[model samples]
Target chain A: MKFDDKIPIYYQIKNYIYRQIIVGELAPGDKLPAVRQLAVNLTVNVNTVQRALGELISEKIIEPQRGKGNFVTEDQGTIEKLKKLLITQQLQELYENLHQLNVTDTEIVSYLQDYIAKRKQVQ
Target chain B: MTNTIEIKNLNYRKNYRSILEDVNLTIESGKTVGLLGENGAGKTTLMRLIAGVAKGASGKITVANQDGVPEKKSVISFSEQLNGFSSNMRIDKIIRFYEDVYPDFSTKKYNEMAGFLQIDEGLRLSALSRGMKEKLVIGLTLSRDTKVYLLDEPFGGIDSMTRKKIIQSIIKWKSDDAVILVSDHYVSEIASILDEVVIIKDRTIYTQKSAEEIRSKYAEGIEQYYESIYEGNDIDD
Candidate 1:
């Protein structure tokens, strides 16, 4: 629930949860923090936290139960699929941006693989 | 959900002096909106219009979409700026009055919030300081679980630390489905919690938009943006 002014709060929250899911920090079926508690911790409006949670629930990454709270979806296969879809979307965006800059196909492949290697090294 | 507040082409005047003209505003479903204006800028007049506290002003105001804006019902709670509070009432008695009035009131929640706010439940209203009174108002208003909660100058006359505490209390109490309209001259204090900033100036709705958008467009903080707007328009010389 930490708020950074540089990004839209909901997107920041979504990315935080997504990173947790990717790194196995937040396991499947784990119950996340409540909106009010998160807001109090982060010093942000509950509405901002609510919007982020609502988006996560709508994406099927989390399931919300009345009077119980929100829980991480327990479908590993679906999680993997969503991960693949998101990666594809990111790659497509990068590819388009590279094409707009008129980088050659071979250059693009080399640059991409090099960047991926650097990312893996850092991780 | 019923409309919490709706004002249609509202025109208000005091002895041939226009207070608000052609003011069309609505506080609908689920957003907490911050109403911002300087002194004598008609924020209270608008609140009174919606609360049915003032009449003979030509306008249409619908609180909870009730016919003629019912007498400040439980659905809409208007906490005025430094009024409607009696020094003789004890904190416990006030809590009881609220519990008896609001069908959706939660005494348990009220006591919990009061405890969290460090309010002495046994103290009389006169014994408490200004900051404590503000905190008590917030605790009471938020415990109602109402559709519309309109707070006027919630951050005024309090120390910085107490103001931060009150703001946190507001964030904790508000639900996703409720609409909170807060008006204050202390715009910078509550700027972070504001989803939308509506400026009432010169008897009209001057500007209304998200704080981020306003900052980006004006390339300045909200306080500076407001100052620039009024400064340019207030050239008497």
Candidate 2:
């Protein structure tokens, strides 16, 4: 994955894995690549990969079993919560940008609805 | 026992011309450090000194707590010079020679790397391309289980595909307990694998920082940081 150099690499790595789960590229109980394999595939440092995986494990998004590699969480409830958390983060950024443009919260809601509705109509 | 390399007051002179002077740096094990500089910045000289292939003037270099000495040469594997091997030696014969000479050389690992890099056993060094020669050098260098691996511009004068293959081999074969120091003028090509970067300018180490720190602190990649340093607008990006 190409990383944005503005962000910490471990944070970007976590986002990449989170995105895999959110988009269903990684299903529940699906095995994650070994840490070194991921490191090599992504061209990232091994210690950085370890830190990212550690965060994922602690967050309960991915779990590690003895002798087996990490896997996506089988807990659907937790997965749903994580998905919501990610969406919320994106919305927060969008809202802040709009706010910087002097748009109100109500205006943001209306403009987003209008934009999406127009986009759907175009399709 | 330190698991680190310490360069203390190192200096190098060639034909009465000073190359590097009073250089000091500490590189810890497990880091893939990049030696970054423009041409004639003494990057190669520094690597050679660390490998103990060339002696420095009035200074000391210690790898894993031992001074830079002839016997300490065993601790370093250099990707540049395949000194004793003749031009006509086939790939397989060279591997055999390495296996017989360096007790640390792993024949099994070499075989695996040869297949992975698509290097034919029957190919001769004189017949190989620059990229292929680089791959061969990398394979031979990594097959030796040494404390330090110095790759001085292994990507220089090579094709991108071959550089990619060499990069992959590096990631796969590097020992977790040892360190790899790669010197390159092209920062972007090797930035992804680098843990830390040592910037050498004007014949000495100018600065050293982790790749992550450069990204976070400067809000830019290692390449941008290098550019900023050149533009005299350091940290603006």
Candidate 3:
């Protein structure tokens, strides 16, 4: 939960929760801790925590239960979409960094092939 | 939402020296604001004005939708200087004093805070360490069910463990309709917990900004932003 100073903390918190979901640490339909508990655990402003949760609720990634706390969405389709979105985002960052290093699209394809080959050798 | 605390055209002059001049700021409810400045930057003076403690402050100040009258003081809880109390007073005695005087004071909350801070009821004011005194003061300040809480340097020279406890206390007890304004010289420690930051410099309200906005806009933390300002750099936001 250590946030980078450059990024908005709420956005970071949202991504942290998303990563947990994709990694299977936070299962769908699991109840989130109370906002106060999350704030204390992350050492962040309660308002910031609320903002992050607010976005999740709007995104339908989480939903609030009456008189109860929030819960991860049980929609398997949404979870799969989220997983794909995160992978795409990570590859975008990697692609941009490689392009900055003068890596062309063909070069990227070759790099991925070599990367897969190297991984198989290790296996 | 309307501002929970507002100060307009506030000026305080002490001994022919202007402490704070032409200050204007509005703090909304459900926010934790950090008041940051170097030594003699008038951080404490502004808090006192908001608390209605220090006098000769001329300007418009309001708390919890009421003008800065003695009645309005009920809604504001300023961190107490435990030094003003008798040295021999026990912790429980001090709690009793607050409960007896402030109708809004919550004994149950005080007990919970004291338990978290581990401040014994029998410890004398004189015998308490600096950190303990701060803990007691914080316990007393937060014990009040007030709309605004003004904390002045609660983390000054405090140990890391004690500071973490204080931070946790704030997060646990903060209300949605109340605003907590904490003034501190230690920026990094308080940066993460702040919703917004009000920077005071050169005898005026320098700038007030949301912490997240500052981070996303400048790619800098509140600490780095403060340093950049002191270095004569411009941050438009």
Question: Order of all candidates by lDDT, from best down to worst?
Answer: 3, 2, 1
Off by over 4 Å in 3: A104-123
Give the distance in Å from residue A100's predicted Cα in candidate 1 to where it truly belongs. Answer: 20
**What's the CA RMSD of model 3 in angstroms?**
2.0
Weakest 10 consecutive residues of candidate 3 chain B by summed lDDT: B75-84
Looking at chain B only, the TM-scores across the models are 0.89, 0.94, 0.97
True contacts kept of each: 0.27, 0.53, 0.76
In model 3, pairs of residues that clash are none
lDDT per residue as tens, model 1, A43-112: 6667777788989988999999889999889999868977887788898998889999999889999998
Per residue, candidate 1 scores C-alpha lDDT tens digits across B1-237 of 555677788998888888899998876676667788889899988877776666767867766657454545657777762266588878888888877777888888888888878888699989988899888888887887777888888777899888888888888877777888889877777766776778898888887777656554544566666776778753121
Higher-DockQ candidate of 1 and 3: 3
Let me know the DockQ for model 1: 0.21
Instruction: Report every candidate's CA lDDT.
Output: 0.77, 0.87, 0.89
Error of 2 at A51 (Å): 1.5
Better of 1 and 3 by TM-score: 3
DockQ (Cα-based) for each candidate:
0.21, 0.65, 0.75
TM-score preference between candidates 1 and 2, better one: 2
Task: Give the best candidate by lDDT.
Answer: 3
- List where candidate 2 sits over 4 angstroms from the true fold: B235-237
